[model samples]
Target: MMFDAWLTFAVIAGAVYLFVTEKLPIEVVALLVLASLLALRLVSTEEALSGFSSPATITVAAMFVLSAGLQRGGSLYRLGELLAQIRRGWLLALAMMLLTALVSGFINNTAAVAVFLPLVIAATVANRQPPSKYLIALSYAGQFGGVCTLIGTSTNLLVDSLARQSGEAGFTLFEFAPMGVIFVAVGVAYMMVARRFLLPDLGIPEQSDTGHAGRYVVELLVGEKSPAIGRRGSELLPDDAGDVVMLEIFRAKQPVSSPRGEQVQAGDRLLMRGEWRDIEQARKKLRLDYDHVARDLDGDVAAERLHAEAMVAPGSHLIGHTLAEVRFGHTYRVRVQGLHRHRLAIRQPLDRVPLAVGDVLLLDAPEKSLAAMRSDPGLLVLGERVQERTKLGRALLAIGVMTGVVTVAALGWLPIVAAAIFGCIALVMLNVLKTEDAYRAIDWRVIMLLAGVLPMGIALQNSGAAAWIAGIAVDLVGGYGPVVALLTIYLLTTILTEVMSNNASAALVVPIAIATAETLGLDSKPFLVAVAFAASTSFLTPIGYQTNTMVYTAGGYRFTDFVKVGLPLNAIFLVMAGLLIPRYFPFS
Candidate 1:
């Protein structure tokens, strides 16, 4: 290998290792890879940053904004709520599968999944079923739906860009629909079966008892001058307490579990579990305040205010801080009642647990503070809607804009990228979503990841690394004939996708697929189509695709669940793609 090829392989190997271990957020890892390439002089700064301006990146970002507008307008929620009325589990699952896939075919799958997420969660809550059963299906549906159209996923667009870059015609809108629809049909059938046997029914979430606001356990200290010093614990708080339950009382450092009628004393510690509103009321009644927070639960709970669930958003600066270090109470004006990490809930003495990207916080904050937290991109309020209901006029306008964008692109009046950008502008002008929120709606993490990884692909192609890899693949599989060579490319792309960003996978593997086809003296379009379809079929891992990651925490699923359900589905897809790609594109 040449110097450039060696450098490219080294970077790829490092990136793959980092992605697998997840020591750093994938976006950060991607940026690091980009910076390394720049430092190595493998590519110019322009090439390194070209992905930011790439149509695939812009289209994905615009789609996010557009989806945010629709979500903000309450159109998606309304549909979700309607779907929540379905009592039969199988029917509901089918509806979600079909709806998510259908919408994803037109819009970005991440946005489609996000819009539908709350609905599935709410429906699961109402049905007293575990969200785990349905969320994976939703993620899978998004992938299937995304494959149905050119704009359905950034992966497809990335492949299209690669094709054009490689001197081939780009895919027109709906060009993949025929094959994509078949794959979607197969996916839907597979998911329906998985719903019955593969998925787990987790029952009601532990926090469900606290109602839609979520539950939190907090400790409060009684001041010497507090009004409730002589009062019984039950009487000191509200009669209903809004699902708040006093779990324990510590008098003179002695533990008392379920102390309902215990009299309060100055400096006495009380452990409580309840909703944010209830916690706030109890704190006020006890004269507890944020400034008076005890050093530990044994000391006091004065500084903590309310109880609710807050998820660390992707790209949040808050990712690696412990509650005490962050001055979390003072900083966010809320106290964390519990920590839910990796689907496991940890309660009490939460001072040292470091927050991660997907860790959900059971927080206690005042109503005003909680409202403020809602707008903070660093934290996401869960199990409730803090924003106002979407206006019907604005929602209708958003729907119209989305339809217009799709129409123009489908008709070739404007490219998907331009149409999507115009639609974003329309959303803001029509008051469907605010300009600031529109920008915020775009997940910069994803944007930067795509931007950073695109250049890596350029580097690979420029360094002859892509062709070298493709030639080797062809040599290894060419003896097996063209059909097997096609299957090998499709399978390789699918595997790579599960371990990396779909766009990056498509970018890296498409060149190899093209080279392999050329080596076999066959039309490359079949191989290209196979790679495109394969790249979008990321079912084996939660981190494989954007939509899967979105649902991972929301559904409270383990990584193994994806593997369990996705493995079979992936095999089925591999077979389906191998059989169908040549029929559609023709290897001869």
Candidate 2:
């Protein structure tokens, strides 16, 4: 039986690695784990499914809906707009980093990062700075800042809930505030200092050179039989595309990626980057005559556009709609170029394929259209954009309801589960969030991931595997005493988070952290705190946190970008937490 439990543990760890590495779609990985557990009889099907209803899961879902309400209300956007006007270089970066860290302390870090990315880019551009410098800082700041509060990130919430289940007093919003604030302050100071010396001034040379706008250069040809053969360049291009500024037109000569709009002729070639697919489709439909001779002309023009990516929310209006039905071009003035169904590639024509929540869509549209599409309840824009504001009264009311629910639960007036459900209902009734929006905000991938992984945690606890692991942990640092043991838990969780999803890492490590604390007969609060902070502070790799991944592609950062900035910050936090945990909650 013990061997069986260990085998279950091995299976789960391997599965989590594969899932986080994205070798398989997260939902599929989850479903497979659930099936395997049931087949092996390690846990009953009911036990495996119970995590779906767990309080932690409910709270996470409710928080997501609450984030939507806040986003819809436009409060986040307003905050972002204020940040964009700051012009001092290092001072501006510090302000943005501090604000991001503060905001992330109270909301999902991923949402926090998404909301601030555009603001950071705009601010950098306004200050005549390269966006790449600020983007990396913003991503790391959000992840680290979330450590300041229990509601700051999902990892904190998960750890708190697990502590409660272990019969310990769970953390309050402010419980972690002291350490979090200090860490963020130190981090802000570090960034302010580093920005001056370490970062390069790679901003585009001219006002016209706005690389921060995220446009790609590409080439398009006018086929001889196309409808646009005789049309003027300005007339053939849509108003949005025309505004992008064509750099040049190549005719029986070398290629041009940017052609002057007025210079185009029937046999002319366009060298452009802004919304190329829309241009190509327009050219093909119009039957113009030319060849894609821009030496830089790349494969799949649609994929080259920066604005072409989207993720399906859990309960979006788009869930059942096909691209054709939505008249993606006619309605939104955008093209659905690629679809990721359940995180796997969907090779079929997007027009004929039905959409589902969690499916990622690659779209091609002008920048303005792309911005509008992001705020649309039917689609979750994957690219970074400025946050938008909605009805404030509604947003406040929803926040008030959540506050009340948390208050009630803390007071023992209601169970956390009941309070969460009540909060969900209150948001809907107040019209702060629509029923569909609320449902879509829930990340079923996370819910399923948690559900599938919980049983394995249980198996670890049920079998002697946890004890064996704990014993090894104890021996490795036994001479160093309980403080070392606490540090070990924190370091282990931190390391795991760099390679896996923070939530998944927490689920795997919390059980071990708890068991280790028990073996030492010490207060588990410090150990739990370590796990919470470590899981939320995954900065070394983009794969560690969703916020990191969100900024990775948008910032055009390579993998080493994360390592360069994050590794040092991770070390700083690890040391700070190790020192502080012992001081705050000493072991007997």
Name model 1 segments beyond 4 Å from true.
210-307, 313-333, 343-355, 365-380, 384-388
**Per-residue C-alpha lDDT of model 2 across residues 1-588, encoded as one tens digit per residue:** 678767777778777678666667565676677777778777677767766766777777777777776676677777788888788777777878888887787666677677777567656766777777777678778866888866677778788776676677788666787888888888887767665655444453232332332333344555656565555555666554433434455676554443434545556655543433454554455554233233232334555345455655433566567766876665776654434332233323335567654455555566667777867755556434545555668767866876787688667687666776787788888888789878877766777776766666666666667777887887788668888888888888888888766777787788888888888888888998999988888778866777666566455566776787777778888788878888876665
Best by lDDT: 1
Give per-model TM-scores.
0.80, 0.76
Q: Candidate 2: where are CA atoms >4 Å away? A: 167-169, 199-331, 336-372, 377-392, 402-417
The local lDDT score (0 to 100) that residue 27 gets in candidate 2 is: 59
What are the Cα lDDT values of the candidates?
Answer: 0.77, 0.68
Q: What is the lDDT of residue 77 in candidate 1?
A: 65
Error of 2 at 40 (Å): 1.2
